[model samples]
Target: MSKKKLLVYGSIILSMLFWSFSFVWVKIVYLIYNPITTVLLRLIISSILLFIIGKGIKKLQPIKKKDRMQLLLLAFFEPFLYFMGESFGLQLVSSTLGAVIVSTIPLFSPIAAYIFYREKIGIMGLVGILISILGVSVIIFNKNLNLIASPTGIALMFLAVAAAVGYSVVLKNMAAKYNPITLISYQNLLGIALFLPWFFLFDFHDFIYAKPNIKVWIALLELAIFASSLAFILFTYGINHIGITKTNIFINAIPVFTAIFAYFVLDEILTFQKMAGIFIVICGLFLSQAKLNFFRK
Candidate 1:
């Protein structure tokens, strides 16, 4: 593979590692702070880091007339609407169930891509998607799934995933006009601004009294610095370099990594069902990348 391919692929892997461990942190965060507070702190820290990185360069100026609607839409879905929906859903649904639902994102990305952009998924791509979803399902859900996660909450979470998929689909179109660092910085800032009213109205006072401990602070920083800012940049780079189908396969590893981290760090049990799920997902992930024609050499 060429240097560009190597860089993009490597970046995707690193982003996966960062995101993988974040699952553990997410649970830890919920223990102390409300989900909105946790999410807000993350966005705040992340926006600060991006701002620091882009200090010398001029920031993305006033949103362009043409781009304003699109940018607002991106912020609403990815950061504002998506986070609120997922966080609320977690309160109602099992985390495992939620993971299974979120993992479906990869399955859905291709469909979204195909319907909107006229992208085609070959036979291998379809197989990979199905296997990954099956694997995720096996790991996350067993006999006890309650379909009654408030219809509104469920709709919001699914919408969040859809919105993220939208971001991936449209990201390439905007990356050309602005610096990646500047663009992400502005995006996060925009998200922060969008949620400012919600934050103050709901979470501002809570975090003030919550006095998040050092562990909480560390976890939040990890969320902000690595997962939110750095990982997002890497994610965008990979998508731009490799296309969405290939870049999103990295999510296939999240279930396995999340389980392992939960086991070691959080002491979440690795039950037979969980193990089965991991095994299934890994198999699917491996299968997803098996393009035989590429290996004929």
Candidate 2:
């Protein structure tokens, strides 16, 4: 394989690993601090490290006005709305369920692309999307539970999914000018700057008063360093080289890893339905990406 292919594959694999474990880490952090405060703090740490390693801080060049606007939009769709919705959803639903639902982002992305960018939703892709959705629903709501009972949580998770889909579309459109690394890094930095006012107004007490145990602090640190910063770096690289539709497939691993984490850490038992749903979801995602659908387009 060519060097470009190697970079794409490596970036995708790292992105998958980072995201696979991130769901568990965020859930663990929420145990110590509330979602808003926890995510904000994580962002702060990530921004600081990124700034330091990015350069002496001054080495970062000034962003153009248009690109600054793009960065703000990226942050709005990603860290702002996506993380807000996800952290809130995790508070209400299990991490496994949140991971499963978020995995359906690829399904939603094509729909968004179709609507926003005049992209087509091929029959095979549609089939894959439907399969993934049903599988995720099954994984989330086994025979024992009703999906409707936690409508708020379900809605929040979908919002996160939608925000992610929106981010992908935005990135696809913006691919012409800005490098994905600049886009992702700027978004993170902008998100940190945006949260400053909120930090003083809302998270002040939580930041000062909250006493997170060692493990939760460690988890938060991992979230900032590995999951947030490193994952963004790798994902930006992969998304640029491989394209978003192709790169997103590895997100399929997230639900499975989350299930494993839930089983080991949360002591959650996996039901037959959960196992079955996982199959359905994987099938759906595969169908959604089937090459025949691309030909149909």
Best-fitting candidate, scored by lDDT: 2
| lDDT tens digits by residue: candidate 1, 80-165 | 77687777766665444455456556766766776777766555656766776666555434467633345565565567677777
Best by TM-score: 2
Candidate lDDT scores, in order, read 0.71, 0.79
**Candidate 2: clashing pairs of residues:** 128-288
Give stretches of model 1 more than 4 Å off: 57-63, 91-100, 123-159, 282-297
lDDT of 1 at 114: 68
Q: What does the lDDT come to for candidate 2?
A: 0.79
RMSD of 1: 4.3
Model 2 per-residue lDDT tens digits across residues 1-297: 998798788888887777878888988887768777877888888888877766663435556776767768889887888988898898888777788888888777777777777676778887888778788777666466666327788799999998999888877756656654455567787777766776788778876887889999899999998888888778877777777777888888878888888889777677787778887887888788765545223
Q: What TM-score would you give candidate 2 relative to the actual structure?
A: 0.90
